[model samples]
Target: MRFLETDEHDDPILSVVNLVDLFLVVIAVLMIVIVSNPLNPFSDKSVVVIENPGQADMRMLVKDGEELREYESSGEIGEGEGIKAGVAYRLADGRMVYVPEAPAGGASGGAASADGAAQ
Candidate 1:
């Protein structure tokens, strides 16, 4: 009579199956979180993350077209191909206002404006 009373809860294999199922659920949740992030590697839009922003010797991580590059600041200005097309002023309210420099050429000014905001 006592042997006949053993039921589903008495099976040790069921406990192992439950543990595996819990692990699978946790793994699925982690995968979803990783893919949904804005800066995820699988995302299409490129992202640039600045390390120690506003510091002269900071570093940068640039992602473009599935490629990644790291740039470190040397605390000195570097030569680059671009025009200074705007001046940004931080207002009292902690907001920035960018005033576009006068157009020097036909398309150069437009390109600078588009890229300046990214910095």
Candidate 2:
């Protein structure tokens, strides 16, 4: 009966149990912060995050669907092998207009002007 009546404060394991509880609370808070982040991986929305913009060590994170792509700058002007697909112009009203080039050997198409109107 004396063993069962031992003081709880005198137990050596009590301190360890408290420490474990503190760590569990800390981990829970961290998990909540990660889940609430806008760029969380579990999120379905696509996002683009640029780090160290315009610097030599610049990096870009592009998240599309479930795929995440990382791009690091090489400290040089980037050159890509691709043809121009369209032209964008700023109208007097500060609206952007995009004019897509017609495919080769195809009839000229009307300019799909801004505001979803055909010109």
Candidate 3:
């Protein structure tokens, strides 16, 4: 009779142990996921990182109204004044696709001449 009573009480303790084990497993999995997430606080900023990648050189420029900005391969950003808004992207194939700006008149004409001479 005494042994039967002890076994009955052991069931409650065993249940508690199983519950703790289950929670431990859950916490471990959550920690793994947090560490592996790309947006985790410990991760680096999400910028284009080029490894020993191919020679696919590219250039991107952004403009806001009359202001133009250039982004270089060495990660240098430059700003300059321009006419109408436009964006220029130089692809790896050596093709420069740019948005048309406002009609040229004064400074633009000289700039165009200089650019053509340089090429």
Better of 1 and 3 by lDDT: 1
By lDDT, the best candidate is 2
C-alpha lDDT (0 to 100) for residue 45 of candidate 2: 94
How many clashes (backbone N, Cα, C below 3 Å) per candidate? 0, 0, 0
lDDT of candidate model 1 versus the reference: 0.78
lDDT of 3 by residue, 1-119 (tens): 76556665557888899899999999999999998754455654453333333343555444434444555465446688856665565757776655445565734322222134322
Against the true structure, what is every candidate's RMSD? 7.9, 5.4, 14.1
Which regions in candidate 1 have their CA more than 4 angstroms from the true location? Answer: 77-119
**TM-score for each model:** 0.57, 0.56, 0.35
The best-first sequence of candidates by lDDT reads 2, 1, 3
lDDT of 1 at 117: 55
Cα misplacement distance, residue 58 of candidate 2 (Å)? 0.7
Name model 2 segments beyond 4 Å from true: 1-5, 78-119
Candidate 2 C-alpha lDDT tens digits along 25-80: 99999999999876898999999999999889999999987899999998887688
Q: Compared with the true structure, what per-residue lDDT tens digits does model 1 show for residues 3-117?
A: 7797997899999999999999999999999998756888878888888987987999888868888999888876889888678777677666676676755553431232355
